[model samples]
Every structure is written in C-alpha cells, then in structure tokens.
Target chain A: MTLRELWFRLTYPLRQRRIARDLREEMSLHVELRAQELLSRGDVPDATDASLAARRQFGNATRIEGAARDAWGWHWLDGFRQDLRYVLRQLAHAPLFAVITMATIAVGIAVNAAAFTFYDAIVLKPLSVRDPGSVVRVVQDARITAPDVLPFSAYDALRKQARTLASVVVTTPPQAFATILPGRSPDEPSIAAARFVSADFAPALGVGAAIGRWFGPDEDAAAVIDYGFWTRSLNADPTVIGRRMIVGGRSLTIVGVAPEQFAECTSRKPSYPRNVPHSHPP
Target chain B: MSQQTLAAVEREPIPPGTLDMLILKTLARTGSEQLHGFEIAETIRERSRSVLQVEEGSLYPALQRMLVKGWIAGEWGHTPERRRARYYRITAAGKRQLERELESYKRVSAAVALIIQSA
Candidate 1:
C-alpha cells in the first residue's frame, strides 16, 4: 500500500468512535479466544496477566485513549492542518513550478472574488433607490465622454421624454489645474480640481451632504466641493458655505461640502460618446 | 513422532519431471480438507520424502493460477485454534485433470524403464 493509504487505515479507527468501539470489541473477542485455547493446553496464567499481554501486543492502551479524546476535540482539523503542511513542503521542493502555479491561482481567485463582491453589492443587495428598476444611464451618442462629464442637454431631454427615463441626472466631476491664488500655498501656485453638478444629482443617487445645506432641485450656478477639499483648501471656515468660487471659468456658490463616500467613483464605468447610449435609459 | 516431525521440517529435492502433477495428486488423495498453507507445504515435503520438495513461493503462485483456472477454490477461515488462515480445496475439474496426468506419467515411466533394462 502507498504511505498515504496506510496512514488513512491506521488513523481511521481512532478518528471514528463507532468504528473504534467495534474494533475494540472484535479485538477483545480475539484475545479471549486465544487465552481460552492456551488454558486448554494446560498453561496456567492469571486473568490479569493475559489481559496485560493482549493490550501490550497492540501498543500502549493510554495512547489509544488519548487519540480518541483528541478526535472529538479537533474533529479532523489537526489531520487537515498536517496535510496542508506536507503539501506545502512538497510544493516547495519544486520551487520554480510552485511559484508560477501559486501566482496564477492567486490572480484567478482575487479577480473572481472582487467581481462577485461587486455583483452582490450592486445587483443583488436591495437598495433604497427610487425607481430602481427604471434607473438607467443616458449618455453621448458617439460613446466617448469623461465618466463624470455627461452633457446637461441630453439629460434634460431624457427627463422630459417620460417614456424613456424616470429621471435623468448629470454629474460633473472635479477638473484639476494649477491655481495661482495668493496664500493658497507657500506663496506658490499649486494644483486644485473642482466639480459642478445639477442640484438633483445628489438626491437622484439617494445620498445627502453632512454639513450645512444642500442645493435646491432647480438651483443653477451652484456647487459642492468634497469635504477633503473644504477642510484643506478653505481652512475649515464655517462661513465658507455661502462663498462663491470660480470652477470651469463659471461662477458657482459653495452650498456645502459633499459627503465622504461621494468623493469619487470607486469603479471605472467606461465613458461613452455624446450620441450613443452608454447604459440603458432610465 | 519427533523424528517424523523434524524430517518434515527439512526441504527435500524432487525429480525433474511432472512437479505440478504431483501437487495435484497429493491434494486429491487427502480428501481436500481445509489446511493451512504452511501445513500443506510440510505435508507434501514429508510424504514425498527425497522425491519432491515444493518451494513455498512456487506453491503460492501455482495455487493462485489454479484458482484463476477454476481447478481450485480459495477461502479464508480459521485454523483449528481459530487463527486467521487461508485454505484451498480441489474442484471436480481438478480431480479429472489429476486422473489424466497420472495415466500419462505411468505410461512414460514404464516405457523408459523397459528400454533401460534391455540396453
């Protein structure tokens, strides 16, 4: 027999209580029969001596008892852990192939887990979103625009149609550029990005700002920078909420800082051109 | 009894021809009782005296082949003391085969002996 098969056979009795009980009974019967045969042959021995010899031939009695106890406590976990260690040692002996195989398997497992997590969160998990089934993306016909830069007029038409979309909202992400404003840094120009969005955009996504007030649904020429920007750029000024700022060469009042999670898109949803449907129409 | 038992323990050489045939005859004469493997080897060695000595290794393989060919059947049981053991018994086909082989050997031996006497 192979070493693995022998190991399995030797351990099976100890691993299972029912099998161990049966084996103990069978072994006792065998020893009893032999002892009786010896007695008939005129060999006189005490009952205790016969029992001791029978147990000794098998191995130490206490070892078997300990094995049975440990089986209940760990329940094959110890054996599986040992097997894993042995497998690792064997893999290490073949270093080059082991490395390649491990790398390949790790990449495959990571990608599969990430995709499943996203699918579970976005598609399977119930959302408090409005018209969730009807919510869809209406984008550029040519299928090529920045993900944070959907056109306002296209969104307006989709919202008006009523037959196509329940509602349409446009999101304009922050555009970063070199800022020359005095006292912005150590008397030197530095990079800053700003965003502009329609008021309904925050409510459409069903999230709200944490501090101060959010913009009204029909309010135009308004914006909300990220909380990180508000703290670092405006020096945490409480009165900064109603201040005007230049974004994309257009004037917009800072209504409030956006909430933490609303900072950026964690996933890269591909940008589509101006005339093509990027996603199903909402 | 001691001499016979001691002699039984020793190996004896056999005549060159018809080794397997002799084994078949021995099993046939014994009424095919359930016998331990070592006992079978010892019996054949003692009864044949200097004429035959079947190696224990040869017996096992031959018995296995016989089992496959349907000449004998093997079964696991106890010895008289109930120790785990295997026993072999000849089948009807094996008895028939023994009869044919014995006759062929008798004819050949007789013919060879007559030619040697004349020469």
Candidate 2:
C-alpha cells in the first residue's frame, strides 16, 4: 500500500473520529511541508499544486475505508452505552412502578437470603471436606432418576467404582427422645438428633475432633459425638471420651467429640436404626 | 414537577459516533501505551482544547465502553503521581479507525458545506 493507505489502515481500529481527524490534519501538514519544500526549490506556484500531484499518487479514500473496516472489527460499546443511558432515563420516569418493582425484588431477595442462610447452616456448610469443589456425593443411579435414597449394595458399589473421588463417607441419621436431669420441670424428656457415620466421615471434610481423636478405622464400638451432645446429654464431662452411652439399643464408647459447628448429613436414608433396615451384612 | 426530564438533559448520553472517535484519536496520539482513565480524559481535553471539552464522568464511561468493545486495552496500575488508576492503551486496530474516520468525516462535512453554500 501507498503511504496514505498505510496510514489509514494503521488508524482504522481507533473508534474516536477526532483521533482520525488529528491524524488527517497531521498528514495534511506533512503534505504541506513537502509541498513548501518543492516550491522553495522552484517546482510550482505553491503547496496546493504539489498536494494535488501528491493526491494523484495516493489511492482512493473509499477503498481505504473499506479496507480499514474489514481489518478492524466494528466498535459497538458506544451504542451499548447509549442504550443503557436511554433505559436508565425511562426507568427514572415511572417512580411508582419502579418503587413497586424494587419492593417486589426486595421481598424476593429477603426470602432467598433467609432460605440460603438456613441451608448453609443446616445442610450445606458443615462438611469438613478438603476443597469442597472437588468433592462429589455418591448417589445411586436409581435415586437420581427418581427421588429414592440409595440402597446399601448400591452405595458400596459406588464407593468401589468411583475411584476418581478423593473419599466416600456415608451417614444414617436418627432422631432420639431422651430425658434430661435438669429442666424447668426437672423430669421432662428432651428431643435430640444423631447420625451414625463411617470413621472417614470427619476426615473427608477435613474437620478434626475438638477433643480426642475420632474413632479410628476398624473401631465400630467407638463413636465421636458432637460438643452439644456431651453438654446437653452427658452433662459436659471433661473426660467423656472414654465413657460409654447406650444409644438406640447399642452401647457406643465416646471416643471423641466434634465441635459445635460441625455436623454430619441428616437426610433420610436406610440403615438408620430408628428409621429402617438399611444396614449391610458385616 | 418531576425533575426526571431535567436530570435526563443534565446527564445526556454521549453520542456513539463522537465517543468512538474520541477514544480512537486519544489512543492514536498517545500510542497504545498504558494510560489511566484520568490521563486519557486529560489528553483528549488538551488535544481538543479549541474544539470540545470532555468531562471526567463522560470520559470514564467512554473508556469503559471502549474496553468492552476491545478497541483499546486497560489495566489497573499506579499512576506516576502515585495514585491507583486504570491505564489504557490503543490497539493496532484503533489506529486504523482514526485514519478512516478522519477521511470520511472531512469528505462528508466538505460535501455538506458545498451543498449549503450552493443553495
């Protein structure tokens, strides 16, 4: 390309027309400079004649524009800002409608916030897993298709086949009705909840035992209860880790206690002693 | 009386044609070197001192718009005066647009002037 064409192509992507105007002005200056140089050397009447001659060598402006647009993609942000400003103006005009819409949005936001807070506290937050983004729950194919919980054999198979997962832990939660020693009435039974989980349960979520070590692998007779469990049921004993308690017709040694914030899964499932016969054969 | 119409006039939208041209020329003169939002606005103001005046609020929106269009690039960095600022640089494509626009605008304006004078 010639010098003028080359300059046009170089500045094509610059969206500001003023920049183009400045460039054109700069080019015109250069043309005048060259023309004056020719005139001083006794070439012609003035720079205008020299510029006309220069223009003959310089290609058509239309071709240069086409090439510039083809080379540099369209700039659309200016139009978008224009549209946004227009919308903001329109929204500002109708105060009553805007207030009503905002009120509806505010109500919706509050409800969502409350529900999420409850979910994060009770269901989602307690898992002490390493990089929760990498963790996946092992649900049965049948459960995914329908809404039923996984059976014992399916859970076992899922654990065996999904080797890509970091770890697999299961929980069978149960609700218990127990009598507390010190109450307003002094002989009232309190409602409590508990879930039975594998030894790797706490380790899967990266949560450590608040007191002693959690039940070691292959130690089914031991149980790691929550801090609330010891405080409310066992009277907050300092040395409760070695103590045994009868829960759901089975005696379980309190091997360790979890922090108050940590909790195991509480969803309905088989093998939950009070709920159903879902335990696998030992 | 609702002040909405008055507010709209007070904060009129920057015409797309003008904004695009301003960004292109700003980048072309400054080169694709990194420039903060304030510096870019200042540069445009100084360059068009005789013709036009650009406000900071309008400049920022135009800069943002340019970034979204990918015509120019920007990044957060410390200014020479030691303030946190967003610096912008012109792309190769922006330079080409400046030249094309200058040619088209001059031609169109000249033609319009000729028509007006003849009539």
Candidate 3:
C-alpha cells in the first residue's frame, strides 16, 4: 500500500466516532420533533400511543436509519447510487435512448481518460530515483529553439560555479554501437546503445547498484550495465563485474549493474543503454 | 374521524424526489421565519388546502438530506407553543433549488397536460 493510504487508514478510527455521534444526534432530533408533532395533534389522548402511531405512520425507523447511515458514510456515493437507479428506470422506459446516451458518455470518458493518462505518463510523473523532488533538469533557451540543450562547456561552468546544486551530471544523447566481449571472436559483436554521462551521474541521480559498486572518478574506463542488459547478454551472472567488454571500439571494465527501473534519461528510448563518462574525468 | 372526513383529508401521496423541493418552497414562503418540523408540515398542508400532509417519516429524512446537502440549515430552538424543536431555514442554495425545481415542474406539468388533453 502507498504511504498516504496507510496513514489515512491509521487515522480514520479516531474520526469515526464523531461522525457516528453527529448522525445519531441529527436522526434523534428528527424523531423527537416527530413525536412532539404527534402529541400536539391531540388525536390520541395517551402520549405513548400517539408517539407510537406517529412512528408507525412514518414507516420503518431502522430502514430509514440505515439509509441515513449510508448517506453519512458516503454522501456523494449515495447520491450517485440514487441517481443511477433513477437513470436506469428511465432507460428501462426507453431502451434505445438509453443505449445512445450511454454510448456517447462512454466514448467521451474513454477519450478523455486516454489523453489524461498519456499526459500524466509523459509530463507529470516524477523520475524513479531517491529524492526526485530535488532533482532538476537544466535547459537552455537557444535563439532558434526555446529551452534547448545546454552545451557541455556551459554545464561544466554551472557545475563549478553553482553552490546550490549538491551535484550535477551531464548526460550526452544516446548513440548506437556494437559490443564485443574481450577474448571473444571479433566477428561475434552484439549491437547496443550507450549514453555518456559525467563522473557524478549515479550520485547525482541518487541511485545505487543492485549488485556491485558504482564507478568512481578514477574509473573513467568503467561501464555500468543495466539490469535488462545484464540479464539479456551476461545471463545475470553474479560474478559478471570486473569483466571486460568492448563498446564503440573501446574496452571498458564492468563496474556495476543498475537497478531494473533505472533509465538514464526520461526520454522515450526503446532500448536501455550502458552509462559511461564522456572521455575521462578531469 | 368519520369516513367522509378521512376521505376528504387524505390525498394522493407526494411523489419521490419532490418532497425536498416542496419543503424548500414552504420554507422560502415563510420569508425569514425558521419553521419547526410540525409547522413546516402544517404550512405545506394548509397551502395545498389539506390535500398534502407531510408525514414524519419522509419529512425528517428529507430534512436530514437537505441539511447534509447544505441546502438548508437547522438549529435547536423553542417553538411558539413552548416546545423544544429543531427549526430549519432555507439557505441560498435551497432558494435557488426551489426556483429551479418550480420552473422544471411547471414545464413538465404543462407538457403532461397537453398529452393528457389530446388523449
């Protein structure tokens, strides 16, 4: 369960009593006034018989109490239930009209839901990382294209100059390449893609390996294999770290394996890429 | 009560979903005077010329619903007859609802009458 749902469930018990008491008092007041009304009418001389007759004429107290309780429990939902019943009755009188109206409403809701889901997935959902709230993407406003990419030099300058940022890492656009395992045949290369990042990429993203350690500044020639790549190519071998692999005609040591959900960028890239630094760290 | 008196006093039951509107109309007519449950029922009965008696069962439930919906507000007060009672007053929402319901009812009844007269 989500933390919010758990918290609500934990706190709900404290408020339930107050809600029940308020409902009881409201219903009790209604019954009391009703009895008084019956007594005032003076049809029956005895107060007890008059009150009883009034209640009987009013109908089942328990059933009305239950209905009122349901309203209190979920007010909007109860109203919706009543409205739905009314609509169904009307629809029963005119089946064709009901069909047409229901179809129109269904299509409208489906289209709206689909659009909202797409927008939520692409724009609203936060990145899957620790402290995602603190992570901010740097975009530069170029004269040609608004909010264009920041140059590596500018990024480096920001990394050095900015005091507010705990850490900043630059990620280069993904490039397609071929991988060749060291000691394997040269003709047996596997096609892959890679995204070059700065030394603090993993730390800045606040992610750690599921197995083995992340690359340090000195490990410029190291590569981190994502869980998907590790499972698909290396068969998820526990001892796959320290192995050497060649990508883009460069040999690198496998230092770590990223968690399954970790994607280097939030872009809609079909293939996950191994994260490596651009050239070597300064 | 005699059979003729009983027959005269009794009328068709009020249709469902219209009780709240009728109660709201009754309260609105009272202009600033908060009416208790009995008084509201009596006002509706008298206005309808004793043809519509608001029973305790339906009246109280409708009142509760209206209170929950924020259409009307109620408070504990003493009746002019010196009895402790819960008096309900029409809120702005209740007034608006009464006007809307009254308009719709008029239109619907007119249409229904047209069909019935033709038949």
Candidate 4:
C-alpha cells in the first residue's frame, strides 16, 4: 500500500462525515446523468418522470452511501458505537431495571470488600500495643500438659511464682452485678457486665485511658468503662469521671473510659454498659 | 418491476471482482480525459452491447475502494451544464492491477476450457 492510502485510512474517523456527504452527492449526480440519458433516448414521458425513474433504478441512495463509507474502513468500531448507543437508550427507557442491576453489582462488590476489611482487622491484624509479638495469652489445656480452666485462687500464686516471665497479670471474665443508672430508679437496677482485673492489667497491655485515668493499684470500688458503654448508657457524659454508680449493691466511682479500639481486648462478645471494678479476681 | 423492461435490455450483472478491471479499462480507453462515475458505467454497458448493467450500489463502493487503494484518483469537476460532478482517473497502480487481473482471468479460463473440452 502507498503512504497516501495509509494516511487516508488512519484519518478516516476525522474525515468520515465529509466523505459521506461527498459520496451521496456523487451518487446523486450519477442519478441526474442517468435521467438525462433516459430523456435523450425517450425512455420516460417527462423530465420529472425520467428523474424519478433514474432514482428508482439507483436503488437506495442512503444504503449505497453507507456501503461506500464502509469501504473506507473501521466499520466494526462504528457498529459497536451504534450498539452502545442502542443499549444506553434501552437502559434509559427502563430506569428501574438499570437501578436494580447496578445495585446488585454494587452490593456484590461491597459484601466482599466489607468481609475482607473485618477479617483483616479482627483475626489477621495484630493487637494495637507495643511489642505485640511479645505479648502472649496463658491458658491451661490438655495439649499444654496443664490443668484446664485456671481458677481465681491461682491469681496470687501466678504473680508470686511466675517471676521467670517478664510480667504476669490475671483477670476474671465479666461477672454479673446489678447496676443502677444515675437518672434511673435504684430499685430497677439492671445487670452490669463487670470484670475484676489485677493492678498490672493496663500496664501489661500498654494501653492507656481514652478519658480520665486508669485505676490505682489495689484501688477499691473504682470502675473503668469502655467507650461503647460510656456513649450508649451513660450518654457520653463529660462528668462521668467521679460519678458513682451502684454495682453489686456497692457504689463504684467511674475512674476512666477505655479507648474504642481497646474494647476488643476486654470482651469478645461486645456487651453493653461494661464496668471493670478494681477488686480481687472473681 | 416489469417483465417487459427486463426483456428489452436483458441486463446481466457484472461478475464479482471483474467490475474493477472493467472500470480501469474504461478509464484507460478514455486516455487523457477523466470520466465521471455515470459515464464509466454507461461506457461499460455500451461496450458490452448492453449485456452488463453496473448497479450504483456496486459501482460507488468499488470506486471508493479503488480510490483508497491508490488505484484511482477522484476530483470534483464541472459538467457541460456547469453542474458539479466527481471525475475518476486511472492511476499507474490501476493499470498494473488491470494487467495482473487479465493474466489471472485468462489462465483460469484456459484451464476451465481444457476441462470442459476433455469432458
């Protein structure tokens, strides 16, 4: 192929409209010439009839015009553009179907994304503390050749004897305690999800308080609240520190609110209105 | 539309791919003068004694293809009545193509002739 032809084909999209007009005009002139030839030969009665006869013999001019343009090249891309336009028009005609289809695809992607985000944060992600790799959980199991379910009686024994390790702390799971809110009637006390932990629980985990402060070592009747309970039941009261709440029939003062992320360490099930009273384990 | 008109002319459609050669031959015969699209179709018909009829559908597209192939060049010119028309002139490539097509056609026809005569 010559460079001239190659250049023409490469620039087809830019010049297609002008080329189409030129082709139609050229074919129309062909029709006019055919009409004159018919008149010279007396094939038709008058000029108008001769012209119409010529047009009839030429077949569809618009179709011929399209075929002539197709010879220039890139007809497949043109056909695809037309098909896309047709699909868009149909989609616009049925707005509900378009919305439903879009929503279905969006929800499918969102579900996978959300599940992965949670799995990464909870199971795969490390705990947010200094030297998280060094921190370990100690529990007795048959596989470890130790007695299962360490009782609260071992709390003092583990601290005194486990001096070989860097640090040792003990904590009891949430215990049942009837709780009274500041605004509510004291008689209608609901169960408060409370935990009793050793003095080194916060220092061992290296997590600090989000508001107020952690409890003092050997402190009595001082309560620490996680951020969720502070907002949900206590209405995120700024004066929550030093405010007293009746738990287990004893008044415990709120000392601090736990940071939001630290809530994962205290409870796995995410209970509400949590109170961690600094008392002996269990 | 009518059997009468069909019987009078007995117009036969040009064989596929032969129209380009015929067009090249028509332009070559015109020598220095360029022939527009209608004249080329008419010349082919008249030369074939009205046996061939070139449809605008085939004629214009073939012209366009030949134009892009560098086998023919078209330019807008005025008719005797001062009306605008596109005139086509055969190029060197068109003459070469015409010779190649004629050689191929002759060889194929001769082989067919040999087979038919044998049968």
Q: Estimate, for each residue in A43-109, the C-alpha lDDT of model 4 and write its tens digit.
A: 7888999899999999988788778888878889989999999999999999999999999999999
Model 1 misplacement above 4 A: A1-22, A41-131, A140-156, A159-167, A172-174, A177-189, A203-206, A217-221, A228-239, A248-252, A264-282, B1-119
CA lDDT of each prediction against the hidden true structure: 0.56, 0.56, 0.72, 0.80
lDDT of 3 at A112: 100
Evaluate model 2: give its lDDT. 0.56
Point to the candidate with the largest TM-score. 4
In model 3 chain B, the worst 10-residue window by lDDT is B1-10
Q: Report the candidate with higher DockQ, 1 versus 3.
A: 3
* Listed models, DockQ each: 0.03, 0.02, 0.15, 0.48
Put down candidate 2 lDDT per residue, A1-282, tens digits, no spaces: 446445544565565474445334333433444455456765557667866654442335334333333333343554677899997888799988888989999999999999988787657763454466777665546745643355567767766787687676666535563523222243454555556666576667676767877766677766676666667666777676676555544556666777655543332321111211224522
Relative to the real complex, the DockQ score for model 4 comes to 0.48
- Per residue, candidate 4 scores C-alpha lDDT tens digits across B5-87 of 45777878998879998999999999889999998998998999888989888999999999999899999999898888899
Say which docking band candidate 1 falls in. Answer: incorrect
Root-mean-square deviation of every model? 13.8, 17.9, 13.7, 7.4
What is the C-alpha lDDT profile of model 2 across B24-95, one tens digit per residue?
777777664766654554466556542344543345445544544456776656645454555678766667
lDDT per residue as tens, model 1, A214-252: 677655655665666666776767677776655434455
- Model 3 ranges with Cα > 4 A deviation: A1-42, A72-282, B1-5, B80-84
lDDT score for candidate 3 against the true structure: 0.72
Error of 3 at A280 (Å): 26
